[model samples]
Target: MAKEIPQILKGFRDYLPQEQLARKKIMQKISEVFERFGFAPMDTPALEYYELLGGKYGEEGEQLMYKFEDQGGRKVAMRYDLTVPMARFVASYPELPKPFKRYQMAPVWRADKPQKGRYREFMQCDVDIIGSDSIIADAEVIATFDAAFKSLEIGEVKVKFNDRKLVDQVLTKLNIVKKDIGNFMRTLDKLDKIGEEKVVESLVEQGFDRNILKKYSQLMEKSSKGYVNQMTQLLSGLGVEQMEFDKYLMRGLVYYTGIVFEFVLVAKPEFGSVCGGGRYDDLLEKTTGVKMPAVGGSIGLDRLFAAIQEMDVVAPQTAAEVIVFNLDENLTADYLNMTTNLRNAGIDAEVVYEPSKLDKQFKYAQAKNMQVAVIFGPDEASARKVTLKNLREKEQRTVDLANLVAEVKSMLW
Candidate 1:
């Protein structure tokens, strides 16, 4: 017979109930932050036409997307990010309110090599503001991200910002054609990953003149705003200025024209930006053929989770507040009724369903981390009373049924 199949995939693992509880708490906190900032929730289909998602993400992103022919023989792919799909959403539904602030939390698929903190399929917590290009939007996005990380109880995170126009001015001065800009920016994007020396080598390998490397290297080294202006001004020598700080940002797509930004964890520098976004002025024209400027950002939930785990900042597991101990077989129904009443009162109570000895029952309650255990013994049930046991304090009280609500309320309150 064939060997038994494993329960999980290579890059994916099953989330146990305790882990799921933690995840829900984390998500709830994030959602609250987003809502407080006036961002509402929205969702779109996970699958999109292959062509729809193709040119939005850059060369590397397109490669990682999971694409295949559907049953109807239509080429489709799981969305790789919320931004691209939102672009399509705006284009398809032109009537959407202007400057819409939306938050989307969903899973996306990618076919990529999995590592310690990287996975092929992962979730993204995205917040986007469409139909505006004001610097205020850009600044607010960064500020909101700052608040979000704090709300998550994660450590300090920095938002690295740059302009696409600067890169463009440098390339234009070098006499590179418009067609080569994509290739050039793609190479520049790897500067963080490959380092200056390797990136220069790759640029040369990509058929760029070696002499052009010196000026770029000098500019890249002097990336500070002051140095950048000096290089562009001195190098251009043109009567009119070009490649202002706002212009030379890293443009991943044609839609993004200004103010690209990313969020990085202070503790894990090499893990890459866990959340990033930028302004896109031309995405509106894709469908409506009308220019509408927009800005947005995405949180890499998977990467953030791993980094937080490494930093030992995960939420503790505590599901049940009170467990109804199971000692007498006949009193099981009584315990169930007690737990049910507790539940109706908005208390987290669970009836221990299994038959066990008295000591074992108490041990089970303790093991489950229950703070309190309600006992419905025959005597207590017959007398129309309940025994409330506070295991942590090693105390017990027999409360009359008339005061049951008040008794439980006092402890819970």
Candidate 2:
């Protein structure tokens, strides 16, 4: 047998203290923003039924799910995403009020081939609302997404918007789709990655006609409101168009019905959509026979953390404010008393390690980043006084025992 070794599986990670601290700070700020928008926090189990996992996430997502059969032959799978599980929750218990709003922060699993900024096990921050069919729901989701990105101080993000119904109308007009929606959609979704010429070639391979291609070529070229206005003038219907420029916004038929959108960072335009979601009017129908409308968005928390770090949006620095150096080892109780007092006074403090030489102890104190050192040596012990030294400023002061806590507080604060 080969030599035994210990290691985490591929596509998994171990976050050290500092790394976790940075990620937590980012999550905290995101939570505050979500709360301000009236989204209440909620949670669910990591394990759920295999039935609950099926036919919800997109085909690609289904392929990446971590599924298994348990000892009793019960089929189960780790939750793949928050949105589908949320849909199940609504159906399982329908007595909840309408327009349900909630935010979930949890880990999701995928068996994806991992690469830079992509992982098999990662966290997602999701916000969703149910039971509303108004356009304001669309507007509110867009506005909230904009606000969340803006609050995070991320780079300029343009949310490309579209409606699947509109695209279906266009495809039907072109006579390109009939029971081959998946392949056609997969081709369209690659429009961002592979250019238009190749997509046309692929469509031609599928036996789409020259006249149909030519007509839609003109349509796509009109990637602006001006073309939208022409479509409106030619047809009899109402639609919207604003700032329609070069946008790679087609994720092709992904369960979205009306008002599909994607959030992409301008810096690394090739990293693909950083966040994406759309309106799904028939989510809970799997759980409940009745159709309930819904809209939501997800922040690829792990990917965003890595990408933002590359863009130099640094996480906040979090460290202990003070360390209490231990001098006069016999006065250990006194040090503990002072440590507690400092904590009560709203200061982060910890006592330095001990039973070492005085010089070594000082070095250890410096290593632990103690700002102020208090000495209760024998001389001060006999005189009922304490010596406090400001390690940062190299200043020393002697104060009577009664005022030791107050004096230390005044100096540190």
Candidate 3:
């Protein structure tokens, strides 16, 4: 038999419990916020027909799609993002209510070279509202994310946004032809990465006059004030405090037709935008042949997780809150009963199946970050009591088995 390979492909990962729990915690917080705004849960296939996803993401995005022919000789590709597949979904099911609001948390793939906080495969926590073009819809999306981050205790973030319409206006005023607006926006999106001088140089190389490039840059610097004031008032009314209007936030997606926003971690700006999305009014019409306005945002979950880790936000090492040590093989039944009672009382409890040494069991509890450890020796079992130890406080107390649930609950709380 051939030796099996023991490695995962580049840009992919296997999430063990510790990492997965943190991600899930973040996702749960995000989902709660999404649902609070009346967004319903949704799911879509990981793979879609190539034609369905093709041409939606612009030239660079197309190149980064993980595309291949399937076993049936059909061209298929892993979804690049949740939004495109969402467009297909709305088109396929016209029966879906107008102003459809949905939240989808799933993995997306990209073939782009992986870098810090960037990956070939990662989870996107997305929430979208379709069939609504109102600015209120945009504000609601922003507010939901603001609430999610606050809930996650990820510290402060600024929701920086810009209007694509304003960018278009600047382009028109600068005599940038319609044929080149897409390329111009794509170039402008790199302003933060390459700096203003390099952006101007790149545009000049693309045949834009030096004077026009300078004029465009000047206009970009000034055009965002009025829009910023308007959005600031709107978002403030919704309790979203930190927002800024950045004229250069031209999100790279060609589909965006209106306001686009990105969440920037104030504490760690080098991690880049942890979340971003924009309005894509023409995309649904383009994909489904039915014109409907839509706007959305996605939290780059892996990146956000990395940021949390970098910030030293402590996450629980294990889901189990209470570990019941099997101190004696003969006392297995007692241990199981105690664990069962704790679980029945809505506490997450685990019991050692095999008898283990006292020190080893305590070490396991500590390693797992278990809050409480219950030991049921023959003495305690005979007395119908258990020794409950608080791993965090390093204290122990004897509680009657009848009151063990309440005692553990109190300690955990």
Candidate 4:
């Protein structure tokens, strides 16, 4: 029989211990920030009925979704993002507290062309407020964005903000019909990627009057300048000043009805926005025929991890702080006892399963990034002593079994 090749899908890759550990730490810190703002945690299923998600995301988003027919012959789609699933969740639970606030960190699948900092399957950390229309709610979500990045210590970032209504107003002034507004907003969204000249050229090639598009460009510039609103003021009072209005920030989601925003690491602007979200006042209504105002922000965990890696943010490679070596077959029980004691004392400890040579065990401890190693051989066991080796500092000391926990704690600190 031929052996199957060990290869991952083209747009997918695996994360080894070091990368996964760092990513986990980043997610934990972001979760902490989310909770600080009084947001509770929630999640939805990976698959939703295809109709539940259809006509929600823009045309491009719909094309990027992984949709198929299940064995039951029901059309289902892998969740493209947390927000749409969240809408479905909220509509399903109408009894949930009004102004429902939730934070979800989970993997979402997209059949997108993978590139640097972009993946087909990636984690998204989302915080949303349902049933609230106050500008303060928008400010709260933006402030959470500020606090999250600060908590990660990922250097400085600037949150660029805009409103879908602003886009509507501009297009209205340009005499663009309501039916054409979505396409126009999508075209304007390309300004950052294709500069003003190319965007105008594309619009003109699409048969939009050159003079109207020229005016549209001027209106966007004029609108962005000196833009101040209740949302900005609320954010200011909340001490979230690392943000500005970006008229071109037309979030591609068709559900957005109001404010939209995104944050980018100021030092890594080339990496693009690591987080983005906005008010989608009409999504719930569309999903369940119940109108509820909602706002949310989502951190692209993969992009965030990539940015931090590029910045060399250090994270622990292992959760284990100490490794208890199995130095003697006869002392295995003793090593197990010590490991349990360390753990019970609120220390993360691990014990090798079998006896091994001292050098080999020490190398294993170092490879696992253990800060301390406990060595209890036949001799030490006889003396009721355990040798504590500081793997990081390369120092060793012998202590009584009674002092084993205390000595290891001191070494770790």
Candidate 5:
């Protein structure tokens, strides 16, 4: 028999302890912002029936979806994004309250070719407002995006936005036929990536006249000024100052019916948009046979974390705050009791399973980036006291067993 080598599929990855901890912290911060804005947490499965997911995404998205028949011979597909599944969720539960506000943090799969920040499987932090068609709803979603980045302290971020209605007006002005509008918009979205010359070439290849595309290129600069001014005034009260209009921000989703916005790190524009989403009023109506309006946005968590690493954001190496050292095997039960007491007082405490050399235990605590260590040697036990060692400061002090929790708390905080 041959031994197998460990492997993982391409475009997927396993996050080590430090990276996962940072990612969780990022999610928690974003979730907190969402809840503060009155959005509640909810979730959907990673897989949905093919019929439910297929054709919802535009052509490009359809190609990138992980779809196949299941063992039961039922067509199933991994969710490519959270927005579509949210539409399905709303349609399934018709009795859900009006103006639903939700936040979901979960993994979504895409069969896309992996790149520096792009991955086949990644977590998305999403928030949506359903049932209201007010412009305030759109502004609220954008404001939430701004708040999330502010909470993360990821430096300056600009939430660029443009309305599909405005894009439609531009397309109509360019004499682009209704049938070609969607394809034209999708191609227009590539302008920032491929540049205007190539976008013109692409649209020309798609049978648009050269002169019209050239005119379209020239009109782009002036097209967004008015809308940008309008949105800035609307978003004034929300404390969202880092926003502007991007004529090229035609998010490639087909369901978007109104405004679309993207969050980009101002200091690192080349890092691309770490989050993007828009309004989709008709998404649920087609399934539930009722008028439903929704607007949502998602943070590309993996890509955001990658940017965070590159930007040198401080992150903890371990979640454990303190480790209880195992000194004497006979006193293991006492160490366990102290660990429990720390935990009961809302501290993150860990105890070594077996008695180990003091040097080895000290090294373990240091390697885990623990702030403090609790040592209960026979001498301290006999004295009814415990030694609290500040790992980083290389300081130690003796405290009564009754004061263990307070002493550790002071050391950590």
Candidate 6:
């Protein structure tokens, strides 16, 4: 028999306990903010019929999908984003109320080359409000994202937003033909990545008139500022702050029909957008033949988590708060009982299953980052008392068994 390989595929990863716990903490903070804004929790399958998801994302986006044929010989693709699946969901269930709002935290796959923060499989935390075309919905989505970042305590972030309609207007004013609009907008989206000179060069190479390109550039600068001012005032009125109007932000997704936005770290602009989304008013109608206006955004959990770690944000090292050490095999019952009492009191406690040397147990507790270690030796067992040691502060106290829970709680906090 051949020895099996013990390696994970490239662009995929396994989260250790420490990383997983930190990820959970971030997700919890996001989920709390979503619920506070009245978005209900929901989920959709990771796989969908290929035709259902095809062409929803633009040409480049479709190329990045993890597509294949199932064993049953049916074409399928892993979902690229939650929004499109959500549109299909709304269409499938007509009885859902208008302006339906939902929050989903799930993994999506993209077959793109892996980089620092880019992964083939990553988690997206999404919140969407459907069946409403009002800018108020857009404001609420932005505001919800603001609340989430504030809660997470990530440093200052700037929300750069623009309306696709404004881009359309600019193209029309430039006499850009309708057939070239998609290519033009896509090129415009790359302005930040490639400099202005390169963008112009690319557009000119695509046969756009240099004179018209220059005109379009100048007009966009002026119009973008005007639109930014209007949006800033509107968002301020809705209690959202720090919005910058970006004329060049053409979110690469083809479905976005209006107002698109992205969140970038103020301290690390090169890290790219940590969160982004926009209005897709025609998506539901296009996919399910039902008209439903929608606007939403997604926080790339993997990227955001990486950013938080890079910023030196402190995270808890262990899930267990206290570990009850086993001093002797004979004291196993006592150790189990004490751990149970602590757990029943709403504390996360663990007991050593196999009696081990005191040094080994202490080392284990330290490795797990446990806050407190409860010593249950024969002396303490006979006295019906426990000696609690603060692993971090290196302090120890002997307490009556009756006060064990209280003593641990005081030390943990």
For all candidates, the clash counts are 10, 0, 0, 0, 0, 0
lDDT of 6 by residue, 71-157 (tens): 999999999999999988988888988899999999999998998888999999999999999888898899898889989887898
Worst 10 residues of 5 by lDDT: 212-221
Cα error, residue 268 of model 1, in Å, equals: 2.6
Off by over 4 Å in 1: 1-3, 209-214, 217-255, 287-290, 358-369, 379-413
Model 3 poorest 10 in a row by lDDT: 208-217
Greater-lDDT candidate between 2 and 4: 4
Per-residue accuracy of model 4 over 197-224 as CA lDDT, tens digit each: 8988988887788776578768877775
Q: Under the 3 Å rule for N, CA and C atoms, how many clashes does model 4 have?
A: 0
User: For each candidate, what TM-score against the reference?
Assistant: 0.84, 0.81, 0.96, 0.95, 0.95, 0.96
Q: Candidate 5: misplaced stretches above 4 Å?
A: 217-226
The TM-score between candidate 2 and the true structure equals 0.81
Model 5: lDDT equals: 0.87
Provide the overall lDDT of each model, using Cα atoms, as 2-decimal numbers.
0.74, 0.72, 0.89, 0.87, 0.87, 0.89
In candidate 4, how many Å is residue 87 off? 1.5
Q: Which residue segments of model 4 deviate by more than 4 Å?
A: 1-4, 211-214, 221-229
Tens-digit lDDT string for candidate 5 (257-276): 89999989887788798999
lDDT of 2 at 139: 59
| Candidate 2 vs 6: which has more lDDT | 6
Cα error, residue 261 of model 6, in Å, equals 0.4
Better candidate by lDDT, 1 or 6: 6
lDDT of 1 by residue, 1-413 (tens): 99998677778756676667777787888888888888889999999998888766767787888899999999999988787788777777778888888889998887878887788888898888888776667666656666677788777676666766556566677788998878877777777777778878988898888766677656654555764454344324422211234222374655677667777788887777788887777766763466678888888887887788788888555588788877678877777777788889888888878767778878877766677777777787789888888877888888996676568677656
